[model samples]
Target: MFNKTPFKGTSRTSSGYSYDDDQFASKVFGEIARKDWQDYRNTFMPVHEIFKTAVMSDDLTKQQLDRIPGNIDAQFKQSQAQASAINERMGLSNLNTGRTDISKGLAQVFAENSARTHGKERKMSAIAGANISPQDARVNQ
Candidate 1:
């Protein structure tokens, strides 16, 4: 947003705008007209750029541009629906921290069961390695 401001007590230079001439300063109306001309000149480049783009765009390009707005609208709606489903499944992002407690409980149960199984296997291996028949062990006892 370019704005036109006059050279006051403290002067600011606008590009291509020269310092106020004593002669020009004496003529307030001329200075106003000069500023107006500069403002109009500044507007030219942007307008020309837009005009060039409009001229170069074909019907296909125009259709693509038109589709962008609609596509954005549809994608936003789909994403919102997806977010709702995810929130419901996860018990709401803000309210639920995680299932850490359940995971830890299951891990403890697994460890206990694994230890019992290892102990049973070790005892069975020792008994088998001894090569003692049940009757021989009973006679020894």
Candidate 2:
């Protein structure tokens, strides 16, 4: 004989009755929101405050400012050395022909890169020193 109870619809007495998908989903989302807010308060707030203070002071040290350019120059030097070595191994002393010179091309690229990096640095410094009204400062508020 067929079991009529198994064919019946879901019932409170069933073992799966305690599980409510909507309630479980809501509870999971609530916990996730709570954790996200806690992380923002505990982890992000301190770093943001420090950066804000630094920007408000508008006093970046020389070492910090030169760090990017110094690193870039060092990398360029290393690349030039490698290129020179390769040129020597290939029996081409300068890698320059009638039309183009590798060294000159590399120098131009370096100049362009340095110009871009310095321009960005100047822009960041200007933003730090610029003043903004309260209405424009907090767009979300």
Candidate 3:
């Protein structure tokens, strides 16, 4: 048995048996499969991150927008109370017109806030879109 030359590469083990072609091929195929899986995961990871960012951004914007009406209402009430106190002190009961001015100011503030929020949403979307590679775009589509 010591005079016999084993096939393929010599074994590193003490058994002295060489690897058969099938065994070698099986190991290579397994390694190739593992590498392919790793590559597939790497390719999709960025796409997943981009998608997560987009979703989070939309959610954050929605939360901000939803809070706006309540905030505006609260601010308007506070301003109205202050205006009412001033009018009371001045003994001007007919000048409840302060409510109209308060409404206008609140409306202006809400409009400005909405514009800024929308602008921020657009910017975040642009950043997400810009980060997509050609490969990522294909994968996304």
Candidate 4:
């Protein structure tokens, strides 16, 4: 008689007969998918931190400009110059533009990771299908 075993690791299915190849494949794929996601997140962290720094610097500059005692025209000119310098250093027109660029980059990373995970899963499924009984494969489909 077949006995169901609880899965201890990340898996597409929660429980299956202990000997099932599909169950093993799902568990292994899940682990690989999780690791890939973590790596992507880690890679994006520096970009996210740089964005945070830019926002903080912009806020600090605005606050300092507010406290300066000068003619409105002079102060406005100084603020514009400082803002332009910051934008240049940040390689963006403004914080919003930087955010848009980062968001697009993150989207691209996500798509690439997803494609990689799907490819691995398809390979595992194919291999498992070849080894499993025909009846089991038909039922899985």
Candidate 5:
């Protein structure tokens, strides 16, 4: 008498019989039809003809591909110039706000204290930018 056991490991049960039935399934449903292949081949066009038609009919210019490197370099240089201009403006704004000055002072103070306490003065970090702000980011007095 084969008792119904989930695993094949020999663990003694009260009625003691391991019923390990066929624990797997087969996937093959076997036999291909010749007409199916003929119909599939009939519906398809060759790659060379496809390419020929695509290139001839399309409005894509050859000069565009040739100019790719110069275009990319010009775009990147323009973006970098814009970013540098923004940074200079931001730095001047920080000097005007006095926040940058205050941060420098705080960093010095922390460094001095850390040095006095542990015999090594080292600067860690300063609060540079905000992570979160109100949706409008407006302060109404």
Candidate 6:
């Protein structure tokens, strides 16, 4: 049998009971929603922070790598000049050839290292530029 209880905004059951089912349900659901939101926020914030830290670390690494080629080039030039001077003073043409070969070897090594570092820099830059967020992944899904 349907109870003809008045549906007032107050917490009262249909059987004239003083129990507030509406308020209790609302409070429970509100607490659940708040807790869910808090959980989502807690999970997402750390992922965002980690992403930012990774991007910053990669940027720093790229900067350090970029300086390496210049430093190597400068050092090579200094060493080449000193070697050429020494060879001229010694009047040793064979020493000049050996120096040239060493220079070529070092140049090749530097070029390979520079290329690899540039690849890493590009990869890191792409990752940083993407600026992806955890929430974005969830939304896209």
Judged by lDDT, which candidate is best?
Answer: 3
Q: Which stretches of candidate 1 lie over 4 Å from their true place?
A: 1-57, 93-141
List per-prediction Cα lDDT, in the order shown.
0.51, 0.56, 0.61, 0.51, 0.39, 0.60
Which residues of candidate 5, in runs, are more than 4 Å off? 1-61, 92-141
lDDT of 1 by residue, 1-141 (tens): 543345345554434343454444446666688889898879887875554344333432334444554555565557567877888898885333356456545655555555455445544544466442332222112
Please write out the lDDT profile of model 5 over residues 1-141, one tens digit for every residue.
Answer: 765555566553322222232322211111134556666667654643443343333122223333444555565557557766887988743223445446555655554454343211111111233232222122221
User: By descending TM-score, how would the candidates be arranged?
Assistant: 3, 6, 2, 4, 1, 5
TM-score of each: 0.25, 0.31, 0.42, 0.28, 0.23, 0.33
- Where is the poorest 10-residue window by lDDT in model 4? 132-141
For candidate 6, the C-alpha RMSD (Å) to the true structure equals 10.6
Per candidate, the number of residue pairs that clash is 0, 0, 0, 0, 0, 0
**Which one wins on TM-score?**
3
Could you give candidate 2's per-residue lDDT for residues 1-141 as a string of tens digits?
854355457533322332335365566667789989999999999976754554444233333444555555676678678988999999888753443345555655666566456445654664786543433222112
- Model 1 weakest 10-residue run by lDDT: 132-141
Compared with the true structure, model 5 gives a TM-score of: 0.23
In model 3, the runs with Cα more than 4 Å from the true position are 1-51, 54-57, 98-141
TM-score between candidate 4 and the true structure: 0.28
TM-score of 3: 0.42
Looking at model 1, the pairs that clash are none
TM-score-superior candidate, 1 or 4: 4
Clash pairs (backbone) in predicted model 4 = none
Query: 81-125 in candidate 3: lDDT tens per residue?
Result: 898899889987745654676676678577658756764756566
Q: In model 6, which runs have C-alpha deviations exceeding 4 angstroms?
A: 1-56, 93-95, 98-141
